[model samples]
Target: MAITSANQLELLQTAEAVAREKMIDPELVVEAMEESLARAAKSRYGSELDIRVSIDRKTGKATFTRVRTVVDEVENHFTELTVEEAKPFKEDAAVGDELIDEVPPVEMGRIAAQSAKQVILQKVREAERDRQFEEFQDRAGTIINGVVKREEYGNVIVDIGRGEGVLRRNEKIGRESYRPNDRIRCYIKDVRRETRGPQIFLSRTAPEFMAELFKMEVPEIYDGIIEIKAVARDPGSRAKIAVISYDSSIDPVGACVGMRGSRVQAVVNELQGEKIDIIPWNEDAPTFLVNALQPAEVTKVVLDEEAERIEVVVPDEQLSLAIGRRGQNVRLASQLTGLDIDILTEEEESARRQAEFAERTKIFMDTLDLDEFFAQLLVSEGFTSLEEVAYVEQDELLVIDGVDEATAQELQARARDYLDEQNKLALEKAKELGVEQSLIDFEGLTPQMLVALGEDGVKTLDDFATCADWELAGGWTTVNGERVKDDGVLESFDVSLEEAQNMVMTARLQLGWVTIEELEAKAAADAEAVAESIAEAEEAGA
Candidate 1:
């Protein structure tokens, strides 16, 4: 093919056709061609020369040029021309003016044509990937249906119309299998751009998959009359979904269940027979949790709001059902309600209550030197510790009809005395355990905590700084084959997690283990403030 005006029109037409086929902009193809042509021209025009090419969009004609800047002296002969040399290109050309030479188009050889083709293909591929990424990025978390195109090492690739999505082995529902060309529905877990192309990740076992299925089956949900609060799934086994209705007339659970369970059954069939329990959601967490534990009646619920934990007492016969097989029921309920749940039979709850009462009564009797009757009275009034007695207002303590002003004063005094005695003993024991005086005097460290640290061999600022918050505060673990919080330094010292964290941070600061720069910066700021105050004082005196 000759490098002529007529041939250039054919080239433009070819570029347009390729752009249309690749679903990319035609201008990108032309730009890629211009780059390729410029590279080829550089080969003939001394590779060091600044060569450029442009193809006219209207005329389909090519222009080749060498670009050189007019300068007082030519430091680089390839890119800069002296003003004297630049004068021939244009009489008015001055320093800094670009001197462009229009060179004739080159006849592209076989090698140049192959290079141009590669450049065009590379640009087209990049454009295609970007287009796919933009189209599907926001569609993540939505449901999508596709055909299984192929399976590679247990990862199924699905053709999602314009692009392909990967359904990894772990994302597939248990017992669910698909072959080539099999139709499949999935949730769009994520869409990410990679070096090769856009990767679309699909999931069949995500809890959101069930929620999306309900949206498809129930118009009430799609129209916003019913809303899905939360979803938890075991995938191909059982799942729990919490729903609520904005309209009082529309029953959220009934709408999700469909007529004779058709809607929920559709979702179940898609999940390969995963059982789903649609429960009504409530603003009250306890009510929501009770609803989440379906087919099992809850007799009583004790909530520890600070810990986000709930203990439920069920009838003796209903304990197994409430806990479910392998604790799946309580686990799903916890996930749905966003709380940790502990299931107990009525008898178990009573026994636990009696044990806690006796323990608290014994603590009051031993620590405050209170008689059994007085200790029982304090425990009944919800006074759990000597600290409460010592810190509680006299007016609050006076509300107990059996206690007079003198008696309340005596109780508070005795409580303070007991705490003081305990601290004094703790300090003595801490010294015996090799705890340093500096560590015992740390601002956030209580005397009792110092004793525990000493016993645990955390005898210095460095030792305390090395511990994580969980090491000081209690953490959950298996106790007697049941998962419960393990006693730690905080539990033994009766300190909160926040206080423990603060104590550890204080230790780190004291030891100069970290935050030295921060401490110095703060010190500088304080010094500057002090200097400003002194200047103001001097001015006032003057």
Candidate 2:
């Protein structure tokens, strides 16, 4: 191929056609062509020569040039020249100046033309990939309609207009099969740039997909009058969604359900007949949980906010329904509420309460040296621990049936003596285990807590300061979608996570690891951030 006047305009025409086909900028194609031509020119001349090419954008005229840099020491003989040796190219050539000379365009042979074509194709493909990535990166977390192209290894590849999306087998609803050219609606779960090209991962089982489908079907959700607070899905089996309405006149559940179940049914049909339970969202977690566990009457709801756990007591007859077939209902409800739920039947809850009462009675009987009836009376009166009986107001004990002032006083005295003896024993045990006086005097931690810490090898103040809040207060961790109990060193002492955090921070302050001013500044910053968030949320609500 010769770079003659007849073919000069053909280069620009080819660049425009290729750029239009790839949907990339024409300038990119022209630049690629220049690079490919430069490589061919280098082959035609000398590989050591610095050859360059430029194409006029409008006229497609190719310009070839040989560039030599003026340098003090000419190590690269073909590309660099000393200042005295560059006098012919320029009158004042300095040590850092470049001398350019026009050169004839190369006549590319078959092999050279093939290589140049490969270079241009590679560059054009890279530009196309970049364009696709930029186009889909912002479109993530949205719904797109695509046509199924093919299936490879159980993964469905879809043509999602200007890009290809892979819907992995795990991301598809149960038993969903698609043929070529089948139209599909998918959620754009992720977009990533990789060595191959842009990867757009599509999902049909994602909870957000259901939320978006509801948004499409329910006008109120799209208008922000109704908000989808939470969604939990079992993919093709069942799902739960909690919604709230800002307008008092609008019922979120009714609006989502639509007239004659039209709106929800639209979403369900798209999900391959997945069952959906629409519940009204409440600011109160327990109330929301009750709503989430609909169709099953909840007798009681006890929530432990710090642990993010809830206990629900339902009628025995409704136990199976609350737990669903294979515990799906409760699992979805737990996910919807973002809490670990433990559902118990009415009879089981009653039995558990009775057992707790008996256990508390036994503790009072053994520690306070009281008879069974007196211990039962103390347990029934809401004194669970010796600390409560020892430190509580004497009038609280006196309020118990048949308990006079003298009896209350005697009872308090015995309880205090028992607690003191236990504390003394615990202190001795902690000291035996190498507990330091610094830890004992640091405050906030009781004698039993110190013993627990010492047993756990946290014998020094430094060790206490290095301890994490979760290590001092028990917590639950999700492993493989199941909540696992994590035992804390001081959990038996009933130390909450906040109390543990404060104690550790105080220990750090006492050890000069942190200053009070830093703590105060951090607290102020956190308070300001929280205030800003609240203001933003209020504005959004309005």
Each candidate: what lDDT? 0.87, 0.93
| Count of backbone collisions within predicted model 2 | 0
TM-score on alpha carbons, each prediction = 0.80, 0.94
Query: Tens digit of lDDT per residue, candidate 2, span 15-128?
Result: 999999999998999999999999999999989999999999888899999999999898999999999999877888898999999998889999989999999999999999
Q: How far is candidate 2 from the true structure (C-alpha RMSD, Å)?
A: 2.3
lDDT of 1 by residue, 1-542 (tens): 34686687876898899888878888988898888888888876778999999999977788999999988877898899887887877999888899788987787788877877888788888888898998899899899989999999999999999899999999998788888999999999999999979999999888888889999999999998999989999989999999999999989888888899999889888888998988999999888888999889999888987467899999999988999999999989988887888888999889988999999999989888878888988988999888999999998888886899999999999999989998999899999999997787778778888888888899987888888887888766657845576667767665667777777877887777669688689779999999999999999745
- Identify the candidate with maximal TM-score: 2
User: Which segments of model 1 are wrong by more than 4 Å?
Assistant: 71-75, 91-96, 364-378, 387-420, 427-542
Count of residue pairs whose backbone atoms collide, per candidate: 0, 0
Model 2 alpha-carbon drift over 4 Å, by segment:
478-482, 521-542
